[model samples]
Target chain A: MSGFCRLERDRSLATRVDGGGGVMTGALAPIALSLRGVTKRFGAIRALDGVDLEVPRGAVFGLVGPNGAGKTTTFGIACGYVRPDGGTVDLFGEGPFDPSKHRGRVAVLPQDAQLGRDIPLLDQLVYFARLQGLGKQEARSQAGWALELAGVTSRARARSRTLSHGMLKRVAIAQAFIGEAELVLLDEPTSGLDPVQAERIREHIVAQRHDRTVVVSSHNLNEIEAVCDHVAMIDHGRAVLAGTVAAITGKNEEVRITLAEGPVPLDMVKTALAGDSVDWDEASRTLVIRFVSRPGRGAEDVIGQALRTLLGHHARISQVVKGRSLERTYLESS
Target chain B: MIGPTPFRDMLLVAWFELKEMLRTRRALVVIALYLLGGLVASRVFVGVIGRLEDVAADMLQTTRTATPGALTRQVLHSDAYREALVRLFPNRNVADFLLGLPPIVLFFAWSSLAFVPFLIMMTAADTVTQEVQDRGIRFVVIRTGRVEFVLGKYLGQALLMSFVVLLTGFVYLAVAWRGLQGFEFWPTLDGILIFWPRIVVYGFAFVGLAGLCAMNARSAAVARALSFVGLTVSWVLGEMAYRWSDGIFGAAWTAIGFLVPFSHKAALWRPGVAGVLPECAVLVALGLVYLSVGLVMFRRKDL
Candidate 1:
């Protein structure tokens, strides 16, 4: 929703993984982070090959790829951890990163970053808050706020080594949310948590979208599609596709209806659709309608007419879906 | 690129490092061992100096007129000790310097000059590398510059060493009061005062060296190994450079010692404020050089 996909709307989602993944490039919203021609090589193997990406402000952007697709490396470069071998990174349009100018504006939850084992969780967070330029009292208050946000306030006084893996992870996530950060980059925020814990984190992350631009890199595409309105798919160290969830999933171009044991009103439904293509699969008992964009008429109007026609015949409709599944789009893109 | 207030950031990091070290009892353990070792060493000093006086009295045939304490002072100020001191420290009032301080305080200064650098390096070796190895530094460096993190690490180690040095001096002062009769508390305290800052500044140089070693390392164990290796290599090279000074770049070769923190330990023995000022500057400059080199490499390294 926050970024307009630069790719032309069509059926084939196959051509985008070369990190040529494009958004409208500052045309739709203010840019939160932009990486142009960024390339990095570790020894002989290239980690990122001219990867380019753009994250629009206040969008829950997901970076999803297979293992070692340079997701973590990209986060590292954005947060000033890893130095890129080539190209520029523009954070909040504040030029290249200089600690003096860009210190407290960005926060990151690095995948492998572990908090101090012997220090209490709260104290560690307070130290991070202080480094973010808060005074002592404010730092403590902010640290407490972060702990509560992560749902780990009870474990605040517990040492990091004493906590469970999930709790420590929540503490790590807590640190990233402190100090009113404008751009928050989380690399695999729920890498190894249970479904319940993961959903909790997703809910928290979803709540942050109204205020902060959050970029998350995860292996969970369903989780990505669930929480993020925008996504960029990276394959082989380059972003192959980037777009809003609806655009990427083709939500505007088609509608799908799954049927139960009911009347076969295919010709009648076609009459309701009028100009659009409507096909019924007898084996699966489903209706697939393709959108034909006409002057001012949209997919919603077509779906409304089809639904009224089908229901008028006393047909049983099990499920109604807009466009396609994210998994289907991802499989097509990859 | 830097944070808005790098200096304040440095202090924040430094304070946290020290607090963490103390909380974990790493510093406390080291300090306890250092104090225990200094106390044992002080006991040895008392025994050794007392026997040396007896030897001096016997060799000079002064046992008939002088008592034990008088003989020790006489032997300490005698021409033999003076010549030996002068030979050890050239063109200086070595005998007067020896007699001006109580013997226990002198032992602490000399022993600290040789031993504390190692202690400081050991204390500092793990400060950055552990966090770096685990990628925990990413969280901090996101809010602070690499330079500040490194500098703050050094300052934290330096402050910890300062505490250890202070505690050792106080422990030795107590040893003198109880173990050495007629210890002249004022003169002995005065002696500790003179060398306190010297010991602190001397340790600062090594703290910087330790920082240089800790940065760009993969693990804390590796950083620790590098610290000892760096100290040994610097020492060997310093010695070789001094020995080879008669060849080409003789002055430059000798000046190379100024680059290593180990070589400056002797210069602190220089008499008077005027003689010691240059050494302080050199030590401070050496600390900065090592730290700057570490910072340069750390800035470019991928964490």
Candidate 2:
């Protein structure tokens, strides 16, 4: 047992760092997972049609879609749980049909699986550990660590049926990290959780982004914006848009300057910041700027220069705000 | 990296099921009731014999001198006794009654066998429906292949059920052995001492049937109910078929009757009465086919 434990610990250390300990993969590797021309149908209803997406590794990816938009179906196909009627899901450059070969490579927090209600929470965690190929002793050890990470270690011996819904959700999320899979899939991890429990789950998820790839799904746009590095919005079974969160949100950043003392001429401000990239809203007493110099930089620099010009015009700025966040951009695009 | 196989995953699944079932008070309650029922029913049979002897003594003054065993033997030879025994132990021997016990005690095991199918349905329904209801099926499907997930659940639950059925059968067999000593209950009772094969067959049947029900049902309770209803209806239909054929279907209907495991045991008795074995080969073959179809259907299920 000692020798096996030492061996597993050594293996863990080796995987955690490469050579000089710099990330073996970049902070976010390009297109860790891809789904192309995916179509699925159940009898007459087409759940997904010509859907396309790419998720970068070592970053948080969010798949945001409404209840019947085929998001879960796509995720299931990716994990090899649901065979697709058409198209393909490629994970870590490997085809999804054969994803079972990547079993220990990814972990999933299924949407609503409470732990075994009849068994202790720790026992359920240990059961997951065994699924990841760990021996009994190793499984028990890993389950202990996982329970701590989930903040349910205190309830480890308690039967899962006795745990609150929030705790059960956390435990489900905790199982996703059990084997330290390179990629983790979390389906609605905080759906029924209280604010505090949701925050804890969010923090745990964010902390894992540095060490692994995560693909999460939720109906809440704010939660998606808060945790996801890349975002994919699906509506009515099609991928409306998908890219890095910054790339999508950065498309049209606007600097809004509100004057406290005097009403500044909107035309003058527009003229000063003028370029094909700039537009002004006179009704709101604001200057709308877009900096198109860089590929995704049409707005950032334009806003910066426009703010300076506003100060030059004695605009008596009351407030400056960065508008057109990803949420708004998504709403506009979709 | 060592990748896991469907078989290995199934072990983990079965192990969890075994743990969960063991902890569930419902399962414990069912098991306890079954054991309690068996013990009490057997003791009642033993007690009833003593009462019957007293009644016989009052009716016949000479019988007061006769031992309970002799009195019972004489009763068995009477025309009224033959008619009554025929109705009482329809599938058993009159020699069994002559040995001083009712046939219902020998076959009380049939009713208790419902627990196997019940547990199987409960386990299967909970497997996929629970995942869907909990919303975890979405993510779990991502880590493991659907085929592995479904097959793992099927095999795991089946293995656990096999253990349970075998354990219960052992207990029942022990009681039967103790109660049937010196009684010509049925010559085949000796051969039926080992029940592992029946457990395996019934386990697989229950697992497959329950898996199909789970795939069709959106909730755990619905799945279990459907499986139970399906079992009950099939057994009733099989019994009707048996009676309509004057039991002359030559084990064809009996083999079909095996679809409802316990019912098949009853239908198999007619062949035993004539000293010929019912064609269990067809029954086992049908069970395997049901299992195969279940596996295929589960592989394609949305969950």
Candidate 3:
């Protein structure tokens, strides 16, 4: 069991104590959620193959996958929405798929799910709160907090039918937070939103990242790029890439030297740096240099050599911009 | 914060359904129709009794000229008149005359019938269909378990349908109890106690029917139509078979009745002397079968 699963067990124990449902003391560790070698197959179609994932105590995780990549299947399995043909899931070191033990600690904003048209947004939140075992008044108060958490405090009283899709999305997010969940599963929290709404939702997830682990799946790579600290990309039920954002996207290094002079011809430089890569950007009058040397070779090594060559050509240098190395590696690898 | 228990989760799902039902105004309309239907049907029953009483009175007057006996007067008691007056309609042995009232009475019973399946559809319509449509189900890999989601959704729909069933059951019972001859209809405690339980049994049947239909379907429209068709077809088959072969199975007709919740409850109650089914055994069987199938399907589903 991972540390994430332990936390969920602790929360359940605490709840049982309060609910007078019999409490077990100090017997279980506090892990939020953990998965090991989970695999799912739909006849000939293998949706998730040998997938292992871990969500830490409090962090924002992003899942990026193309259509039919089993990202949703992974999500469903984690939340107990779907059963895996193989693998073990643990919530706070408790067995996976135990609705009786792990429900209050988990909240999910399912993709494209709309609330009942007749229910009020506030009522919907409160109802979810109640489901987490709060009394009516306590649930109502917590509902307000949930809406505020999702940044939709003003729309609490609005009828679900009257609200816009963006607002509805926010309500769904609010519901995810209603129980002060330790783990939040958000499926496309901002798919169809305008730029502003999308940003607001991203901000909400980020704000909550310090206390609650957020696992979000979205085709909107930009959203994941903006809010995720860790990311996993799936293609056809297998993980093509998985790691921290910096680790996955920062795999290679590139140094761009913007010069005050005209584009210095790199014919000789290209010939000399045979086995390496170099490109000159005319718009910025910058020469971008890329190589697969390694981490030990710093930007200073590339910069020093580039300058020496430029000086030999009597070229003037301006500012230098060294962007993400891993992004280049990811793109190339993919 | 409290951790979620199955009971709490069940309640949360039920609360959500109640809020949705109340907010939609459809619940209110259905309840109103039920009330109106119950009153009208009761009146029809009493009215038929009134006509029968008048006929009895005329017969007595005609017979008084020939045989001036006290037995006729004893049979025509004041309490009998009161029962007839209160009921406002005749209680006939024939099922058609009783069923001929407004859709409210005949239809409202099935209205809650509509709610259970519709609510189940509402809960699960988004299951695999919406996830595929929006490509959202992929996120579950990181935060929750797949089985948890399937079970959670199934439990949620079950909880919601149960609430609707109970509420509508109460409505049916309240109307039926009030419209009856105020305890005059059944003089024995066994009879009166059994009547309310029978109504409750009817409610359980609806819950099972709705849950099973909703679980089997992907769309709300399909769920509703399926439940409706299922109900009608089963009853038709049961009625035809029973008439043809003395209530024995006629080419799987009994199985058809099991498919239609209303028909099953009606048939179950057909053995009762007062047109009510003793539905304990049948209710338990239907509820368990439907709930189990629904849960199993939901757990295995992709969303």
Candidate 1 residue pairs in clash (backbone atoms < 3 Å) = A16-A240, A17-A240, A19-A238, A19-A239, A98-B1, A99-B1, A99-B2, A99-B3, A100-B2, A100-B3
The digit string of per-residue lDDT tens for model 3 on B49-161 reads 44555567688674322222123234434467445534754434333333322222333344443334434444433333333334343323122333333344444445444
lDDT of 3 by residue, A10-110 (tens): 13222431222344356544456677888998889898888877766676998877788888888778877678888888876777755455645677877
Recovered native contacts in candidate 1, as a fraction? Answer: 0.94
Q: What TM-score does candidate 2 reach?
A: 0.75
Between candidates 2 and 3, which one is better according to TM-score? 2
Q: Over the stretch A1-334, how does candidate 2's per-residue lDDT look in tens digits?
A: 1000101221352343211222345353355688998898888999998899887778899999878988887777777666678887887775664534465567887755556667788877787676655667867887877777667777889987887777777777777777657778888988988787787777777777767889999988888888988899998889998888867776444455556757566666667665644555557665555554557545556656666777777777766656556668777876
Q: Rank the candidates by DockQ, best first.
A: 1, 2, 3
What are the per-residue Cα lDDT tens digits for candidate 1 across B58-123? 797866432224455665668897777768765566546766777777789989888897897677
Best-performing candidate as measured by lDDT: 1
Q: Which is superior by TM-score, 1 or 3?
A: 1
DockQ: which is higher, 1 or 2? 1
* iRMSD of prediction 2: 5.7
- Of 2 and 3, which scores higher on DockQ? 2
